[model samples]
Target chain A: AQSVTQLDSQVPVFEEAPVELRCNYSSSVSVYLFWYVQYPNQGLQLLLKYLSGSTLVKGINGFEAEFNKSQTSFHLRKPSVHISDTAEYFCAVSVPTGTASKLTFGTGTRLQVTL
Target chain B: EPEVTQTPSHQVTQMGQEVILRCVPISNHLYFYWYRQILGQKVEFLVSFYNNEISEKSEIFDDQFSVERPDGSNFTLKIRSTKLEDSAMYFCASSEAVRSYEQYFGPGTRLTVT
Candidate 1:
């Protein structure tokens, strides 16, 4: 079985400050990692994904995440944030080598970028 | 840009009532999926449909839950008897193909079971 954990349920940051949202996963097989952002009353939009390439993956909205194999973590970061960036972010994992129907998601972290 | 679209942005139903959530995925997409998020909970997978059949389903997809692609463009999830626990935001999604894991999700249908 595979599972994802977003340790922080909520993280508040001042606008323009750097932010990091941590995520960890437990899986026996290789997995694909992704970060999705959800605005209020909106559907989830893909931020970025890590399949099999450079450990550092860059995404839209100046967000980036590092895939650490040893740590089994995919932590998302941004150098600066805007008030618009305040939204719920989810970390998801899917095993490509196995079943194709599922993407296990973390509980999500609400990022509140304030003035 | 192309995206998945779902109908009935919100629905209110009494317990044991039947509800059918609808979706229209992006054109040229081959795989469709349904997921749900209860208030303050993680999104959970319900089922995946491809080639007009269910490719996979989770434990939450029991005898009461069914999926169908009645027409070419519409994919629907039918809950025969909605329980209070079944109240959640139901999302319909689609991927370009079976190999594409990054799915495009619809705005979602917020089903409130009373």
Candidate 2:
């Protein structure tokens, strides 16, 4: 089984400020990582994913995340945030079983971008 | 871009009553999934469907929970007897393939059991 841990539950930042949401995972086998954003009353939207290749992955909305295999971390970062960026961010790990796969998600970090 | 869609944005039902949440996954997707998020909690996997049968399911998916792909476009999750704990936002997702592919999500249907 695989699990994800989001270090922070809530993070508040002023508009245009940089922010990072920390995530770590535990799995016995290789895994794929992903970050998703959810607005109030909406479903999750993929921010980015780390399947393989470059450790640094860029996503939509100017967000990026770096996969640190040694540290078992995939932290999401945004150089500058806007009021519209206020949303809940989730970190997830996908573990392949046979030909199928299942996703395990973190508790989520609520990003509140203030003016 | 193609996207997954769900019906009955909100549903309120009494405990012990049956509830069915509907979803229409992106056309041509081969794998479908159902997930739920309780208030103030992380999203949890409920079940995964492929080739008209369930391929995987979580421990939370008990005897009361069932899934069906009755039609080419519709995938439904049925809770035989709703419990207060079943009140949550249920999301439907689909992927072209499960291996390292992105899953498109629906807007979700909020199920409220009272």
Candidate 3:
């Protein structure tokens, strides 16, 4: 089984400021990591994924995340944020199988960007 | 870009009423899934389907819940008897093939059981 933990429930940042949303996971074996974003009145949009190679994964909207295997963490970051970037972000993990499997999601981090 | 689509953006029903949520996955996709998010809770997986049958499901998918691919383009989730706790945002998703890990999501249908 796989589980994801997002330490912070909410994060507030000023416009053009860098922000980081922390995520950690526990799994018995190798798994894939992902980050998704949801805007108001919309569905989850895939931001990025970490399947193999490259610990540093880049996502849309200038967002990126690093998969630190030793720490069991996949932290999402952005060098600068905009008001439009305010939304809910979720970290997810899934164990790879011969076929597609389920995704275990975190509680989600609400990013509130202010002026 | 091709995307998954769902119908009945919002649905309301009384307790004990049966509700069927529908989805249309991407044209070339071969896998489908259902997930729900109660207010203030994490998104929970309900089930996954492929080749017109359920490939996997979570405990949350109990006897009251069932899935069917009645046709080539439509996938439905039927709740035999909806409880108040069943009120949540249900999302439909799909992936291209067996090895594809990227799953596209739909706008979701908000089920409000009264």
- Candidate that would win on DockQ: 3
Q: What is the TM-score of chain A in candidate 2?
A: 0.97
**Model 1 chain B, poorest ten-residue lDDT window?**
B95-104
Residue A115 of model 1 has an lDDT of: 100
CAPRI rating of model 2: medium
**How well is each residue in A1-115 modelled by candidate 2, as lDDT tens digits?**
8999999999999999999999999998999999999999889999999988999999999999999999999999999999999999999999755444667899999999999
Q: Between which residue pairs do clashes occur in model 3?
A: none
Worst 10 residues of 2 chain B by lDDT: B95-104
lDDT of 1 by residue, A20-97 (tens): 999999999999999999999999999999999899999999999999999999999999999999999999999884
Cα deviation in Å at residue A10, candidate 3?
A: 0.3
Instruction: Name the regions of candidate 2 deviating beyond 4 angstroms.
Output: B98-100
Interface RMSD of each: 1.9, 1.8, 0.8
User: TM-score of chain A for each candidate?
Assistant: 0.97, 0.97, 0.98
Candidate with the greatest TM-score versus the true structure: 3
What local lDDT does model 2 show for residue A78? 96
Looking at chain B only, the TM-scores across the models are 0.97, 0.96, 0.97
lDDT of 3 by residue, A1-115 (tens): 8899999999999999999999999999999999999999799999999999999999999999999999999999999999999999999998888687899999999999999
Q: Which ranges of candidate 1 are over 4 A from the true structure?
A: none
